[model samples]
Target: MDDARRTAAAPPAGPGTGPGTGPSVGLDIGGTKTLAVLLDAAGEVVAQARLATERGPQGVVAGAARAVRGVTRQAGLTPADLGGVGVGVPGLVDPGPGTVRHAVNVGVDGAPLHLSRLLGAELGGLPVGVENDLNVAALGAAHLALAEDGPGEGDAAGVDLAFLALGTGLAAGLVLDGRLRRGVGGAAGEIGHVPVDPAGPLCPCGQRGCLELYASGTAVAALWPARTGRPAPVELFEAAAAGAPGAAEARDRYASAVAAAVRMLVLAVDVPAVVLGGGVAQLGEPLLVAVRDALARESAGSGFLSSLHLPERVRLAPGRVPVGAVGAAVVGRRAARPAPAAGDPRPAVDHQPA
Candidate 1:
């Protein structure tokens, strides 16, 4: 099997399943769809389900509850048979209270939606934790990395990496030293708004020539609209492969920008890996190669950059699995575990910036 296929089938890692803990369920709740997964104790995805997401506070809770039930049922189990559920949502999330606000796409407005409390109540009191969508994806990527090259020695929490999402927008999710780094105000990975061109077009975030303008999937669409009405990235890559007009240049420019994002992550946090994710990552190997080539060019002139091994650290996110959902399962499993006693040898989350 190819590497992508193998990575897809590889089992994830989390705390072992013990008495009274069957499996964990995770949900990646988007504006249009809710993707759910049932992860067994061994970290293999046993069952999965996708359902149309209903809008509003009550709809969000109801949809999430139904998705959890549906996925668990597909595995011939009920919520009672599961350990816990974790939810990933896009918005300003106060994980402490499991509340989300400003999730306009999901029809959630300024009023904080009590997602965890409501979803848990809907699930007959199953433990539920809600987190930012990108953070869960980062966590999911870190969990998946256990089967990659294996974690570093003395690293017990999990792999340390960055999950760079190249979807409609360009942002990243960071897993530093086996813990999610949400930053102090939960804006840790908002790299898209970082202005790289002072004279470039104005961005909605009030920046000119923001990195998202050059790197995101939306940028591809704006750069090269598909005449065939397919995804712009698909069309652009196909055209470039066919040696069509100006396609390769556009592709390289996009890849170069993406490489910049990778450089930013590695240079700042010095993560060992940067997993390419989000919608555009569906381009697969071609996207990987392009970014690697760009990184090669970037490092060729600077021994300092070369020492970081940027290209070697880049990899595509697992293709077949819902990475965000798998991460939600990891979160759920961790939430169900009891706090460690005093003087436990395990490491706490290091909040100091790198």
Candidate 2:
């Protein structure tokens, strides 16, 4: 989503690395929609499908199946030899067993069973692993950043990485020492619902002024109407860019809230690098410059949170864009690897079904 910041010494793969030649499919399932990419073994997308999200849990699963089938057909492969399928969904996901503990927006609770358990048979027994969408996005970004900073064909660099998704809510995925930390019950990076302002506004979780309401795309849209008669952030951004009085005012408020969000994330996480992704990050320079300035002004004037250094890896995502589905697919490869054997090199990716 961060097109401008993505440009770097590392460019995305050329047009040749599509389906049947790479890792197969990367499926990202969101609260309102689902997308899938058919990649060859080379990790390049051969075909992609975006499906309108449906209501009802079964309807959502059915929609996902439809997308999977669409991409498989495009790739000219049957489900039988399709390596593996990775699904990235919102909510708490257990990476150990690839179980979906809960998907609040997707509407499942108390571990409604693993999607892989039921869909496994249909997917040619391919390893169907589920993961927290943000975690997968982090993996994708990590791979890109590693490739960008390292020798050609980006191997994991030693740098720790944090990927933040700013959408209807806020949350982050962390990577250190080339490994992802899926905390206890898989709730580590679930920052969006965390209450940041206890006395401000009521949140879905019965808290006041959660980070989501103040720093997400939803937050920006909510402030849009007050600044300009229009309620759309995209329109509001354009208005601000054009120097429309109301739009500029609304953006300033949004910037302040977002800066606070950034401060909390950077100061607490203490990572050397952080990359911003999601629909809201598309605001481009407005967000980039505002955040950089905010952190500078606030951090320089304060002693607390002053210990965190200016990040070396604080650019936006690369041109290919960071999508949870691609992240999920990459994770599928990792989860499928055989358990570490004595003295064996780490098998980072596995295409065979579990």
Candidate 3:
């Protein structure tokens, strides 16, 4: 019915039955937009929808419900036919409590927002999994990486990957051996708050010189007004490409900070690859080139750093598909699947991030 729905081949049946046997929904809630993707059993997207994000906790929850319904309707599916729903939010999430601890952009801070309860009620008790947005994006990235490399034991085993997002904020998603890692307190990849300089700039997190303050798209746009009397990140990048002095300096600094972040991640976890995603990642090859050059400069000065091969590990995520939404779908699919019985010898399902 709606233009957003396009017919795709039906997914093949697998281990499950009943409502959980059909397609699942994945929702990615960002500061500005919300994306809903209907994913078939094999994780391929069948239909999708998008809407401007609503402000405040209630509005956000309502918007998410509408998105789910919109995509399912487009895909010719009903709530009862849905397998599960997975949501990715931008702030701190406690999966056990099903709450978003704080997300200023969506107007929830300090006060816990019970997103799962609200969304679950709206969906009439559908199984829902909620996780940090970047973490699910990491899962989606890992899935893409494995898909491109082909299915094999060695290909799927010991797969260590990271998804770096550089949008309004900077953070990472880490997947170790095909499992998402949300460290103690569920803040493993909050690399944006990592102190990069003592005298750089103040961060809202009550820290000075945080990595996000220098490298995030928000930071870049903030610098643009002072340099070119405009506050647009796109214009800033354009100016840098056109050789504007101030814009060039700002661009180079952002690239250097991102390179530093990559180096830190590599030295810390030594993931084999890092997929760059998020709104800022739309800068594409130019941004990738800048980061590679910066990493190269660092490796040139230190033999220890050179051994890390940072440039070889960094890559831009596919810009065409919404990685976060796709990852959330994977999360929902896993959540809906029945757990293996005791002594079944199959690995337990891991859905920590959301």
Candidate 4:
């Protein structure tokens, strides 16, 4: 919006066929796997690739480089044809230097991994930007939102939304006025650690009754462990549908806790949308319906809450896209482009969900 970020109204001549004028590559590096996407100049994901993530500093860099090449090649391009590369990984990241630390999931710790520089070198010095995994997911979600709804008239800032990830642990990624909010200490959108009940069970963060303990995927597993080796969320929902005793109640309780998370984000940031993502979200419509219902029920008695349309604000992340990888591609595009003045346009894909 201000610096190192600008969206194009129209794409270049071809799918990033020239230096600094072609498609960009984005990588979402997780502990188990690395997902990659090739975002063409038209803002569409032209190709994608997935690879087993090699751990440790060396493996991460090499794996990321390989992912970039694989995705680009899938698009019939090469690293040289890419505008830039973007990486999203778990842990603390200083985007300025493209360095990451405390990324335990990727085996990076203590010493900062100069991921951008290292990966850039591996790929012939192409510009590479590194960002926190959650932040990139938020970016990717925002990109999709803008694609669905074109930029508002006279509104320099684009979409306003929060990406709530109910994975193993609960957390959120904030994209306010079309910009990623990393917060001062990079703790923005960490609503999972917020304590709700003073007398509840203790959390790993030393808080009692933290929101995560109630709302996360792990919480669902605890509430209804897999009796048939299927995921707990699926089993719980199926059982509830079949009138399993207490399953319905447990499901509703979990939904209410997630609804609380949505409420907190809307109250704090008042983002117009809250994209439900992460593992539990894989349950799709069931999960979305449950959370929306909980929001409606919890706000029933409060006129103030009803006026906010909190339930309407909740939606599932697009099932068709690898959001994290797409967001990383956006980062890569930003790295390749010059910073436009504040309020400049940003990328928006033209393709609809396939």
Give lDDT per model, in order. 0.82, 0.64, 0.78, 0.84
User: How do the residues 1-354 of candidate 4 rate in per-residue lDDT, one tens digit apiece?
Assistant: 111111122223254554446688888999998888878876677777778898999999988988877777666677888888999999889999999999999899989999999999999989998888988998898888877765342232556889999899999999877678878888999999999999999999998999999999999998998999998999999999899999999999999999999999999999999999998999999989999999999889999999999999999999886899899988888787666568856532111111
Q: List the residue pairs that clash in candidate 3.
A: 130-354, 131-354
**Which digits, one per residue and each the tens of the lDDT, describe model 3 over residues 153-174?**
2445456898999887899999
For candidate 4, the TM-score is 0.90
Query: Which candidate wins on lDDT?
Result: 4
Least lDDT summed over 10 consecutive residues: which range in candidate 1?
1-10
TM-score of each: 0.90, 0.78, 0.85, 0.90
TM for candidate 3 is 0.85
Candidate 3: regions farther than 4 A off: 1-21, 109-111, 151-157, 226-231, 339-354
C-alpha lDDT of candidate 1 relative to the true structure: 0.82
Q: What residue pairs clash in candidate 1, if any at all?
A: none
- Candidate 1 wrongly placed segments (more than 4 Å): 1-20, 149-154, 341-354
Candidate no. 2 TM-score:
0.78
Per-prediction RMSD in angstroms? Answer: 5.2, 6.2, 3.8, 6.1
Give the distance in Å from residue 325's predicted Cα in candidate 4 to where it truly belongs: 0.4
Q: Candidate 4: minimum summed lDDT over ten consecutive residues — where? A: 1-10
